[model samples]
Target: MPPPILVTGGTGTLGRHVVARLHDAGRDVRVLTRHARPGESGIEFISGDLLSGRGVDAAVAGVETIVHCASSFKGDPEAARNLVRAALRAGRPHLVYISIVGVDRIPMASPIGRTMFGYLASKLATERVVAESGLPWTTLRSTQFHDLILMVARKLARLPVVPAPAGFRFHPVDADDVAARLVEITLRTPAGRVPDIGGPRVYGAADLLRGYLGAARRRRPVVPVPVPGKGARAFHAGANLAPDHAVSGRTWEEFLADQVGDAPAGG
Candidate 1:
């Protein structure tokens, strides 16, 4: 039997799906979560926090490869440092990291973007550490998830008119597809800084919202507001998309339809 693989953030949006995929493949799997719920059959769960390396060491024990999905977008640099140290001590050979597209090109937008930049910066810094550590590694940078789009659309639905950030375009990929690609990366030999993953096509923020409203049969007006700043400028310029390296299966429309189902008459 192969050695157990350790997955951090196994209960998160993408992590949970990854865990299920690994289990389905019949791989010996162990997850590190702050809270371990019972009835997660065919897998082992360990309670731990990534910030202080609390249960990280034990979780990595006897594990050959690690799918490191845990992250602190707000305090990325420090979190990356701690996780790198733990992975080093455990002598793990392969480390697969999931990061966002345009981390290097786009400036931080809101507080969340600033924090996410800090986190992506930390992931980049850790990427260097893994490269220098002589351990095999793969870094996958993906576009925004479909779930993020749905969340944004739901928030916009609250307003009589939906207001969208000007010029920002998204190729929203499905989280499940991203997870599948990540798992495939783990199964194969490490490819340093793998190709960028993106959704099937590019669509502006307004287009996404309109599609959502149309699907739900809501007739809310959409207002596009352009902000003046590097972040805004970058998004308006479509900095988050990589046309040359897109590897996603589901389109944004397909994803929205799946979530919204059929629109009712006169909805």
Candidate 2:
């Protein structure tokens, strides 16, 4: 039998799509989850956790490639380190990591950033480990996911008026698109640091919220509130925007439209 491709965060937003892509391509896939279950037609699930190292060895065993999309916004650095240690022990050859763009440039904004902070720092740390571990690896940095906009919109909709950070810019890419890119990287040679991936268009936070309002058919006033702090500064400066090597794809409007159409009525 051939060695299967192991995917961490297999049940997550991006991970699910990645697993499906690999399965569709006829590649044997094993997904690491908290609970192990019977193989699903073409995919295998292994119960494991990166923190405690529980079932990691078994999950990684016999797998030649690993797509590491699992991450904790709170303990990303430590989580990444733990996963790398296990991967080394299991002797996996290729490691592909999904990370966010502007991790380096952005300063700590919220408590999450102050703690785990930019995914760049965590991912860079892990990338160093993978590079030095003598394992073939690829690290992909991408802009925010399109789903994030909808999430923000929903949260804001709960309030009578939407109060958002002022002057914040984002390049939101589709999760499926990012997953496809990651799978493509896995199938090819391991490039240490691939080009950054970003959405086709760049928009301010207020603009994105307006689009979301229109798509959801919810009329609400949007108020832009300027935040005071490093996080706000980073966003206002367009740190998340892609100046060069912007990997274009579906815009936020397209993604929101699809999501709104699929959602149950009155949702």
Highest TM-score scorer? 2
Q: 1-267 in candidate 1: lDDT tens per residue?
A: 898788888888889889989988888788988886663566889988877778878887878888888765555555555666777787855888888887777776577556535555566666666566566788898898888888989998889989988887888888888999999998988898889888777888888888889888889999998766676677777778977877658777777667896633322
In every candidate, how many clashes are there? 0, 1
**Global Cα RMSD, each model:** 3.1, 3.4
In the predicted model 2, the residue pairs found to clash are 113-117
Q: Candidate 1: global Cα-lDDT?
A: 0.79
| Reference-based lDDT, each prediction | 0.79, 0.80
My TM-score estimates for the predictions, one after another, are 0.89, 0.89
Clashes of 2: 1
